[model samples]
Target: MKRSLSLPGIAYGGDYNPEQWPEEVWAEDVRLMREAGVTLVSVGIFSWALLEPSEGVYDFSRMDRILDLLHANGIAADLATPTAAPPAWFFRAHPEALPVDRDGRTLSYGSRQTFCPSSPAYREAALRIARELARRYADHPAVVMWHVHNEYGCHNAECHCDTSAEAFRAWLRDRYTTLDALNEAWGTTFWSQRYHDWDEILPPRATGAVPNPTHRLDWRRFCSDALLALYTAERDVLREAAPLTPATTNFMVMHNFDALDYWRWAPELDIVSNDHYLRSTDPESEIDLALSADLVRSLAGGPWLLMEHSTGAVNWQPVNRAKRPGELRRNALAHVARGADGIAYFQWRAARAGAEQWHSAMLPHAGTDSQIWRDVVRLGADLKALSQVRGSAGTAEVAVVWDWNARWALELPSQPSEEVRYLDTVRSWYEPLWRSGVAVDFVRPDADLSAYRLVLAPALYLVDDAGAANLTGFAERGGTLVVGFHSGMVDENCHVRLGGYPGAFRAALGVRTDELFPLLPGETLGLTGEVPAGASATLWSERLRFEGAEVIAAYADGPLTGVPAVTRHGWGAGTAWYLATQPDAVTLAALLDRIRTEAGVEPVLDGIPEGVETARRRGQDADYLFLIDHGGRGAELRVPSGATELLTGERIEDGVLTLPPGEVAVVRHPR
Candidate 1:
């Protein structure tokens, strides 16, 4: 709601590190930016070492020139604090500031994010630099937004050093307040892990065997808070200098990183931005893109920004596959369709040297002759064409419950099965909903479910008392809730529920799970009952004992053969469906189809089918329908007769628009 960047349309730009290039190329950079319609560029993100060559010695000449150049060219800036990578000189002055691995090995300062989150020396230096930057650029006309510390906790989320251990103790003391309370919450009675004094407690570092689940879970919470504390500290400094400017840090809500809980961090930010790249392993990364964008959008509760993504292959992955022709525009527009207000890539110009030289950029190393550069220029025009689409909002009828705290507990040391991943399980349900052409929004379990007709709770290993009540209450109301396997198994403290599995939902579900029946990898079992024929499941199964529930399906050959594998229970005015198995894609799609019909929750668009994604955005002038084709062939979409396709400026008098593979159509229907 509080976007500081007042642009003509959706922002189109990328991170610009002019320090990487010589001064001679600076003129051409802005010239090409103008040619490509670059509106905003993130500056000084990884320039800490160069900007502060010595301790407290400021060298603002380079950055000053960079800002001047961008301002002169009429481009806005999202100035950064450059705290992500502390200088080597600072590290040398405080070697202990370097992060320590879980095994107690001190990591060197060669890479970015090498400083420990809890180190006083690192914190002081970072804040000092931020203060200096804010004081200098507070009134700079080029500066539109303050980007606090690039992507917090990407590399060093957890630090096992002595300083971090002390900080962890302090954090725990603040949370638990008393040793007895801490002991009870942590269940320290088992394995003699109790703490009589706060000083005795330390982070869950490497041990002889599996560490305490509660200990690990709390440590994850502490690490996220520590990193967030770093962001808030810098943000306060910027706020003091530039009080009106909005501040935000880019979040990696994608699959790779899951350290910081954006649900906790979202409130602290004035704007929400996320960096996502298409994973090579996932051939259907397009659906994953929708999933990630939807989560970020819901966190923002409105439009967000795509801070960084690859124009081509990312250097970090094992096999960095390049984005096929037209894929770049497809990816960018997909984010826009999912409530992204702007689009930006990782870097403006490709790095000539360093760790991320191979990472794709707007201007590759091959210069303007490449297809990537051509596409970049075209995307800018395409964004400019849909200027009216900015500030549009997306609404969803279905919500997928996401709790980062639960994610931490689900992935802790010991569990039913390693394959029962938190994000994977959530996506198992989300993918089907996406393919079904249903628009989904992500929310915490305790968040208000009144807006949604259907809510999916998946992989919620740890649920607090409040969340448990909230889910039960939602089901008791008119909202149809789907409880997945491995959810509601434990409380917030990682303690297993006493009465039965999924203890949090037994009463509302009208059934109880006695035990878990985890299947081996590559193993699957069939189901018999109301589900589609050949409906089977993989990876997980559970023992169900019904109190008063209708069986939707029964396990045919698993450990709980002839027992109910899926159950539906009706409470007051709503319904709760419990799927005790990780159903195959076909089974989940079929099952969700039934649930959608019963709940009266349908896809966003009627004729939209699988392999093509569609989402509607409401604007003051009209309702915009985004049609993205990910299939192998062509597809046709019918819209209002008076609608106009914004991308191609084609007036749709016939109410039919043809979309080929890897293409996109944005049809604006007059209100």
Candidate 2:
């Protein structure tokens, strides 16, 4: 695995926008940063309006001062291209730069990401700015990495104007080659939607005929491609100017956007980065963040960056709640515990005026020296002392296949319950592994499965023949497999296979499922044999007939009461288990406990309490244990003998380690 960017201790600093403040404030900002143990500051985010006020006008005088100030303070800066949002003048001059909504209404320049990615005017202007930034800042000592357009796909789709239509047609031609090939791939003959000419294809939006499934799918693909093309244009400009500095764009994990197919764009990035936000305080939140980090790390096959996070409460949600005292530190450490190399926040100073003025920031509107600022400084100090953890990578014995193609194909089907979401199912399986303290790699379906003794592919909806055969080979070779409901139901083209559900894995799983029942919201089905209270028995229930498998649990009530809800089958030296219904957390945890024991996957720590997560990473000679307390109250954790706290310099040997709420500790085992 490639090494991540994070050093051993902790990474310090937050967003810094010198453009928003005066020259005198820059010095004060640096002083405050140093005081807070801030080692890095992200500059130039949302500075397009200041950088370029008009067409053909370029200004970097202020940015130069900002860089000089940071360098003087010995701080590293993650510089942005200032291309996330073009100036209003550019959009006004080239009206085509405006994006059009799904209903065909052209968007105004009131919001960010309003520029149409397909518009030549926007692309040309964005590339020019990017080239200028790269050329000007390539040799600056303060600069660490180049951050491309912020969070690439906030816009759902782009303009349906003539320019976009022509580009869409070109994209289709490249993908299908000929009109006949396009017709066959989309299976357009079913709805008499066969296209005689490429021009017949129109952008799928809320406007026209509600769109056929094939066109809708292609439109999503086309939109993602367009955005990626935009990203590549800027990336090429930067690469030509400064090949040494790493180039990357912050990605949103499991977002509605098709950008998750980083496999298509991974080569363009020197380091993969993502912005993580969680809504719930449940254990799943940490698992989701870790999964995203693992995905990015797997993409580059190395360490990735935690590009953006809320220093406190974010303003985007309906209710913005600040991060509890130690939550920020705990969260940052959580990323490192996974595979994050670099850590940075969204904004350095809170906005003084505007929609996001109330959003979380490292420096509140009040100058500095607040509690938040103190925590920021402490985090910085910790990071500087602990840079030794940089090259550490997690040890994962199990891998979960997270395929975007399968996700898209499965959701496009008309029959399955909407409650059976792709992300939820993946998370359900992942939660157990995470809670059990077993590191997992969120790999692609085609990734080498031999490295893992256990493989979990929940909701493998779009199982191509090759993919299914791959799983079969793994099972035959003594690798345990677990698959859930709504799996093996369709091919890549969204067409259901005949015979029965789980068509291809029938022999491997040793079972056949013909009928699936969709339960309404809040409906409760029961599970036989000591099922936990509030366990969901009927989200997507299936009738099963075991060919060779033994039933482990069955429905306690309903027409299928006494039928199977869980089954296990032995195949070769390995085994296959099928979960026919969505169960509650307790039941899921219980099921995972059994699976973990059977697979012999070891946990990193024992006697860890709830809300306290444990993860371990090993260097050549030492093992590092990351203990994070996400619980409400402080914890007195017991550490193994002969270990030392890397952060606090305290020696521990099966003694109580005090951890305040939301606190984290990195314990290095004796060499």
Candidate 3:
């Protein structure tokens, strides 16, 4: 039952929608797919309208033919349930199926994922399609895996409709059981908002007054749960019908539009797959991409799928700038470097019409003569050549704790400052690690920390008593722990831990916060003690008192200049470090450098160039080292003397390796 990629090497094609083209075009498309070394194609996504034009009617004739053609061409199929976008007729028949936004306005049918997760009608329809697809393609030679509804809750994660309100109430009842418990947990006595009955509760809609923080927190949890329920319903049907074919729903990793707790969903899936789209705003899109891939691999506990990414410019961004000459290849290899079993795009051919017509694909609208097509073909060949990477697992000695609950709690109406964004701050802290070539795995706060040498909780603002004990246990058991500012400040209910700031972690961290002095947008305080001479603190600062911990760095020049900015405490057999303010990049990197050195955490590869990224994939007998040069310059890299470069089959006995600009190399070292 080790569920994994069914294909031999990295499954290299992408979303192939043959139904959109004429019947005559399919054969040529298949021919081109073969030429491009397409091992797998995800078919039938968003094809519900064509499959079942009316209620209880499914014509799989064309779908069957497409599968047969793919089979004939020796290409595997990742068959989708086509439930992402239900037919327009189904919406006309059951208008209640539509989702309502925060303002309580019903979203129309024309867009994808328009259905409300809590709507019984929508669930019934989605399940029917899932069951049908499972039944028909269970034993098909071409179908290797079942792709569940595309990007669950991408657009409709939260709804303010009556159905959702009722669902939220039911969820709350299940969680709290009694009105007394609910009232206590929500702190309803604060604003005379105590609930005597479940019927009084409503979804947090757009209103002049801010909703209860606990209420909003629970609502976000419920919304994620409701969507997960829909995905589970479909997944169960597919599991029952096609037990052998692994089922997966493509997750939009760290996508702002959806808030589904992937940790909860990971257990239900046989294999984890994710759709990662690079943000245009991020200058370090490569690092962000690697972070997301590592997260998906961690969720699977093994290699996962890069189910969807753009080949070039995506249509959704405000300014859709096409990727430069070698960018696509770099992006694809980056995912593979992390631990992607498959390298796929959002689409095969560019759409001719509709909302995503301009979204770049493996094959553009200009046909196979373009540079994008040439890159696609080259990537496919490269993957085929480096097939040894399949089934390899990415190894990381450091784990960063991530929690959707903390994210929701941090974004609540009342907090320290609007500048403290959760994931952004986490990535900012992670940037130094990534730059230093450290492999990272994102884990839950409650996840077992014994596997990691060091654990960093970046803005883990919300935690339960159990979570607090978990981190403390990690430190006591000889694991180095780093707690950022604002962490452990509140409980699961968004209530302050009143004895002092950073209440839950106080005993473990051996530090107490007196007061929080949040800096303005452009303000910064210079550092003096323990830290590099002239290092500055920005965004936030806390006047901290060392209960038992030794001061690491102290603020140099401000109202709290004499106080400690950073502190480290030696507990049991391990040490715990705390940052009382947001450190600048140089300081953060310097801090991590010390931590890394102390924890005995070494980079995957030594002497890696500044802009070159390195990731190691471990196999039974050897390891594959992936080096990607995003610096646009060539560099000489050191490798194991006897290792062989897989892509070029060159022996590196001298241990000196050269990487060209925008190129990639995978070196295999025998264990």
lDDT of each: 0.90, 0.76, 0.89
Off by over 4 Å in 1: 1-3
Evaluation by TM-score, superior candidate among 1 and 2: 1
Task: List the lowest-lDDT window of 10 residues for candidate 3.
Answer: 1-10
lDDT of 2 by residue, 246-343 (tens): 77788877534554456777777777877887663443466677676777777766567777787788877777777766777777888877777667
- lDDT per residue for candidate 3 within 1-671, as digits (tens), equals 54555778888889998888899999888899999999988999989999998999879999999999999989999999898899999999999889999897999988899988899998888888888888888988999998988998888888899999999999999999999999999999997898888999999899788789999999989988998898888888987987777888898877564488888988888889999988887777898888888888989888888899999989988888888779899999989988898988979989898899999998899898899999999988889988888988878999999898998898888687988888888888888888888999988988988889999998899999999889978989999999999999889998889988778889888999878999999899998776676799889998789999998888888899789989899988998999888988898899988997899999998788799988899999999999998888978999999999988899999998999888899999998
Top-scoring candidate (lDDT): 1
**CA deviation > 4 Å runs, candidate 3:** none
Model 1 lowest lDDT segment of ten: 1-10
- lDDT agreement of model 3 with the native: 0.89
C-alpha lDDT (0 to 100) for residue 571 of candidate 1: 80
Candidate 2 lDDT (Cα, 0 to 1): 0.76
What TM-score would each prediction reach against the true structure? 0.99, 0.94, 0.98
Tens-digit lDDT string for candidate 1 (1-671): 35466667999999999998889999999999999989999999989988889989999999999999899999999999999999889988999999999898999988899989999999999999999999999999999999999989889998999999999999988998999999999899999988888889988888899898888888999999999999999999999998889999999997758898899999899989999988899989998899999999999989899999989999988999999878999899999999998999988999989999999999999999999999999999999998888889987889889999988888886787988888888888898788878888898988988898998897777898999899889878788989988888888898888999778888888898887889999999999998889889998888888888899999998567898989999987899999988888988889998998799988777888567888888998789899888875768877889789999898999988888877889999988
